[model samples]
Target: MPIDIKQFKEASRPLSERVLGFLKDHPEQAYSLMELMAELEGKADAASMAWIVAIERMSGKKEGSATLNKYSKALEELLKQGKVTEAQLQGTTYYAYGGGHP
Candidate 1:
């Protein structure tokens, strides 16, 4: 399941596959949840996107980005299957390639 960046950007492939492709390409680099969301979505900054969601919820009483939630769920699925590693730094979770069972 070697999904290219284009496929991930266009959402032509499953979220899990797209995530794996990115992790594999980056080797051992750890990416935070928001970082992964930005990569998978081809956005330059996911924090800002999250801020938008926050503003919308606070002012407009609207829901956050569903796609970002989908990415989190997909990552959890990968985590449960031992396909990726999870770590916490400064209280924020980060994900890396391999070693999930540890």
Candidate 2:
């Protein structure tokens, strides 16, 4: 079945599940960390930025574990499940939500 962000948003699912649903629903759009967090949580701050960075690292960006620890567990789960992918564009990394190519 196809994923639907509206449906997931209306449900009582966890934040991580909603995030996955959003990614699945828009598999073609590339989302940077800030963009994803702003869209998902309405505001981006230290905690959210750290989570994004962690997810970026988990997506295999050239970064160490220190910055990736203690946050972004939801995205880490998605990465483990192979539901998300990363791409480098103009020297910046962006994440897309889908099983296909990034």
Cα lDDT of model 2 by residue, 40-95, tens digit:
65555646765756766788656554333322566776677777777788976677
What stretches of model 1 exceed 4 Å from their correct place?
A: 1-10, 55-64, 99-102
Candidate 2 vs. true structure, TM-score: 0.54
Which structure among the candidates has the greatest lDDT? Answer: 1
Q: Tell me, by TM-score, which candidate is best.
A: 1
lDDT of 1 at 93: 93
How many clashes does each candidate structure show, in the order listed? 0, 0
* Candidate 1 structure quality by residue, lDDT tens digits, 21-101: 788779769998888887776677878667755665667444455666687888898888888889999999998877443
